[model samples]
Target chain A: MFQTRLEETAAQVAAHLTHVLDGYPAHPVTDAMRYAVQGGKRLRAFLVMESAALHGVDPQQAMQAAAAVEALHAYSLVHDDLPCMDDDDLRRGLPTVHVKWDEATGVLVGDALQTLAFELLAAEQTHNNADVRVALVASLARASGAHGMVLGQAQDIAAETAGRPLTLEEITALQANKTGALICWSAEAGAVLGQADPTPLRTYATALGLAFQIADDILDVEGDAAKAGKRLQKDADAGKATFVSLLGLDGAKQRAKTLVLEAEAALSPYGDAAENLREAARFVISREN
Target chain B: MFQTRLEETAAQVAAHLTHVLDGYPAHPVTDAMRYAVQGGKRLRAFLVMESAALHGVDPQQAMQAAAAVEALHAYSLVHDDLPCMDDDDLRRGLPTVHVKWDEATGVLVGDALQTLAFELLAAEQTHNNADVRVALVASLARASGAHGMVLGQAQDIAAETAGRPLTLEEITALQANKTGALICWSAEAGAVLGQADPTPLRTYATALGLAFQIADDILDVEGDAAKAGKRLQKDADAGKATFVSLLGLDGAKQRAKTLVLEAEAALSPYGDAAENLREAARFVISREN
Candidate 1:
């Protein structure tokens, strides 16, 4: 059920992104922007849709935010894959943006995609109420800016240069900003749209985000390259500290499982309405990628 | 008077930016972001504040929008100066962000600064009305995204690699999107905040923007490098087409003067109340830098 829903959202978000890109002038940058947004797992988009469904927000209304998050996520990946950054040549089974086009196109594509995310959120088509849209934009900027994703990325780079393995506690704090901030934003987006208290969903997303990172660490250790659609065990080669390194593989898996349960329990207030979200937590720890 | 007011707004905007960035984690990225934003002309921020004053918006309320445009402009410069883009070494007579820091820090600092721009615009302190803030965000996205600044930049890169100079008409359209979009946005932001018609300010900004670019082209041809605070004659050196190349230097100067008059005339609707904006148009074509 979770797999089917995730794929469905992925297709819808892809179509929406294509439609949006089509409106811009035909140029290499626009072409690269279109290419860059393709083929992610769309877990962030699915989180947005499922959380919105739980809050009784219309899927059409929620779709805008879903596409926004995916576009924003794509921008981050393109820049992250730059030679000056991670220097990765491949991502999602294809050459990364800088490798496929040039670095200039990669930079502009990422910059424009970030702008497009805020554009989507600010449009009236996203919501009838201006307050909701403003709130959404403000929260997203907070999640993606210096205090959140960027801060986490900076810390990771600093750690690499420092030539020391991060303590388990320090890595936890870093991941909470890097990957966890956007995940929490995706989960709580529905409540923001519906103007409801988001405490429960926030709690649910916090655990889910941590588990998701741990699962990623586990995949880095034991996952197949073909299944993951990218390089594997690169962290181990770099001597970077990861959940699998700090905790034993078995211990990391146990922690992810426990966090999944905590995530499911946090959704108890909505009962069966959150079954899909519960399933999503299980899928997080179990998925190959 | 224009110089005094521009400097005043520059100092205030810098201080506000510092306070906002200080709230984030202390890291290399944040430090680079702070460095990247310093020492600009602050013309965009001045336009925002000056236009806001014309619409009777309070200076305190207008300061948020002023800081937002400056941040956005700063982001564009950091990215544009990257080796993958223009590869500029000097800006405002200082080393470019990538030259001062590493490429990765340059990328991250630019990314964070762009997010900061939207964050400033969406804050409740920018305006009491949510509708006004949303409008500012939407217009800014349009001005800065693929449809505007990015499109112009891509065209520029393509022109350079195509091994031909752009036609007079083509360069005009490119500059309209490149430099003109943000100037227009800054000029009309006050009207947007006051919920008044922006048509007149838009007209004024259109001419002012063109005159400003023409002046830049003229500066490249004849102005002192030390006064310009960056390398001059790069276009002539590259054999790139510019207004001064297409038009004789004298012709370009005359054209800028005509546009400044048009910019000034567009403010007739506000009578003496718009004196500073009128002076701004004159200043655009006359400033050394």
Candidate 2:
């Protein structure tokens, strides 16, 4: 049921994003962007909307943040799949943007998507309070800036050039910046929109994010190729470090379970309203891909 | 005298950008960002500061917008010079970002610098009014989004792949979106900060930007390589249609002069207060590089 809710949220976000992109001059960059964002788990959008629901923020008002996170997440995927970065040929069972269009389109699409995310948040439709909107803008910038996602990406690139795999602590730090930061932003956005306390959601997101990545590591070893879409176990093949490599498969699974539990417990303050978030956290490790 | 003022503003912007980047964790992306942002025209910064001055906006309060535009310009250049794009080896008589750093680092640095620009504009220091800050962020997103800068890039890339020269109107539209949009934003930023009508500055920038591009076309034909600090006449060599190619040498020069005059005339409403902007318009055509 929670999975269905996430799918529903994904659809909602997709529709909103389409509306947001309307009226732009049609170009390959826009086409690449559309293709890149077409399908995803929309986990970030789910987190934003669920988090907002728990805070009593109207979904209409929170849609911007929800869409914003998905847009940002999509941009990351587009860029990370570039020939210069991950060099992947497949994403969500479709050809990567660079492969489908061209590297120029890939780069510009990612660039535009990133800005479109910011533009969505900055628009008055997102929040009535200018202060709140600016805060959202500032927080997203921090979450995705050099101190955040970009920094994580650089470290990953550095590790490959260094010809040595990262250690556990380094991987954790790297993943925190790369994936965890955006997840945290999504979870906290609802609280921000409603001006509610963000501590509980922040805590929940930290554990949920770690669990999510651990699941990715586990799936690399165990997931069905057709379901995963992209190549699995590339990290292991490349001799790069990952949670499974660092903790052993069983150990990583165990840690993920503990984190999911912690993540669920963090939602206690919100009581029944946060049931969806708790289920979502549990879904992180349970999903096949 | 105008050259000296431009240098002074460049220094001021560089210092402010440095201060803004102070606490970011030291990494290759950060290093590349510093390297990429160092030593540029800083013409956009001058426009922001001079326009702010015309509106009696405090230079202190205006510094962030000035710095923000430069950071953004640096990002655009870094990405634009990537192997998939313009693929320049030299910029400012030094290695381009992808040449100086790896391609991955080049992409990350450009990505980070862009968000850093938004972060600076969203900061309270840019404007005391939350409304004003949000407006700045929104304007920037629009200026840099698909409808503006990225659309121009797509058109240019499309032209290259199309294997034919663009029509005069098409080149004009492409250049307007490419260089003109950001320049227009830079010229209008100060007015946005002061909450004043941006019509005069907008008009001034429209002509100045076209004239600026025309002059660049001229420089590519006649300027010394060492002075220009990058490959000149590459567009012509590539069989690209440019302002100079569309119009003859003398015709292009005559056009730039006419645009400069129009730019200066648009600044007349500010009287003596707009002298710097008028001078800037003249400088756009007169500079050798």
Candidate 3:
């Protein structure tokens, strides 16, 4: 039941994002922009909407935040796939943006998408309070920019040639910055936009984000490449660190369970206000890719 | 006199930026972060300060805007210098960030700097109104993101392999997006923060931005690489379109004068309120490097 709702929210957010992005100028850059944004699972968007729903925020308000988060996620993926970065040729069973439109366009499209995320939030109808809008913008900027995901990417790259396997704690730190920060921010942003207090929401999102990463690590190790729709075991091949690398497979699985339990516990204070979020935490750990 | 003021503002803003960036975690990534922010002509910052001065805004407020603009500018430069993009090795008489810190750190630092720009704006205490803060954030986002500098970079890369020489108009469009947009936005942002009417300020910034590019083209043709602190005549070697490439050096100079005149005219209604800006326009066209 939760899967159906997640899928619906993801689809709606993706469609809205496509419509908004289509309004850019019809140049070669636009072609790359389209390519970067067109194919994403919209998982982050789902998190935002689900978390907002758990807080009893209007779905429409949640959708706006979802769209912005999705745009940011799309932009990061585009840049991450560039030759100078991950050098990936494929993403989600399609040619990566850099492959389709050249590296420069890929870069620009990613940049534009980042800007578009802010633009969506700044629109008059997103929130009536200007302070709330500023807060949302600040939150998104921190998650998406250098101190957040960008720093994560930098650490990941530095890890490649550092001549030692990263500790589990270090790996967690990396994932927290790279994969977890935005996800955490997405949930908190939805709550903030919904007029919920951000302090507890942030704590909940952080734990949830780590759980999400643990699940991702497990899937990358165990899931089918075609099913995953992107390269798998690249982490192992690269000798990069992950939760699964530090903990044995069984140990990692056990840790993931613990993390999910902790995440659910973090949501407990919200009481009935967080039922969906609790369910989503369970879904995050148990689902197969 | 203008050069002295530009140098002083650049130094002051750089110092402020350095102080703020130093607070980050001390890591390899942080080193790259410092490298990206440490030095520049701070032309954008200068424009911001000068424009603010014209409007009777506190110079300190202008300094914050200048620092933010410089951060954005530095981030773009780092990303642009990556191997997948322009692939330049030298910047500001030092190795490019990618060359100094590896491609990943370079990318991350750029991302971090971009985020830091918004953060600085958000954290600024001077702008008491949330609406003004939102507008500043929105304007900077537009100038730096997909529709602005990023698009310009994309166009620049596309033009390289476009298999055709671009027309004068195409070059101008490229320059406007790549170089002019952020510079124009910097000036306009200062005015906005100063509570100056933004319409005329934007117009003035736009014309000045183009003139700045025209001057850059002329400099690339005649300036020494050592003095310019970046590669010279590489534009010609790459066959990248520019004002001087489309028009002869003399014609480019003439076009620059025309632009400066137009830029000056845009600020004329402000009378002496805009004298520094008018002088800056002339300085842009007449500077040696």
Best candidate (score: lDDT): 1
Comparison by lDDT, 1 against 3, better one = 1
Clashes of each: 0, 0, 3
- Tens-digit per-residue lDDT, B39-79, candidate 2: 87899999999999888888987899988888888888898
lDDT of 1 by residue, B127-230 (tens): 99999999999999999999999888888888887777998899999999999999999999999988899999999999999999999999998899998889
Worst 10 residues of 3 chain A by lDDT: A32-41
Q: Give the TM-score of candidate 3.
A: 0.95
Lowest lDDT block of 10, candidate 3 chain B = B120-129
Off-target runs (Cα >4 Å) in candidate 1 are: none
In Å, candidate 2's interface RMSD is: 0.6
Ranking by TM-score: 1, 2, 3
Q: After the best TM-score superposition of candidate 1, give how far the Cα of residue A18 lies from its true spot, in angstroms.
A: 0.6
Model 2, residue pairs in steric clash = none
Across all candidates, what is each one's fraction of true contacts kept? 0.86, 0.88, 0.65
Query: Each model's TM-score, in the order given?
Result: 0.99, 0.98, 0.95
- lDDT tens digits by residue: candidate 1, A7-90: 999999999999999998888899999998899789889989998998889899899999999999999999999989988888
Q: Please report how far candidate 2 places residue A162 from its true position, in Å.
A: 3.4
**Model 3, range B1-289, lDDT digits (tens) per residue?**
7778878987899888888778776677777877788776777888888888777878777677788888889889888888878789999889998897777677667767877788777665647777877887878887877678887887787787889988988888988889888988888876788776877778888888888898898898898888888898988888877889888899989988998888889887788777767888898888766
> Candidate 1 — which pairs collide?
none
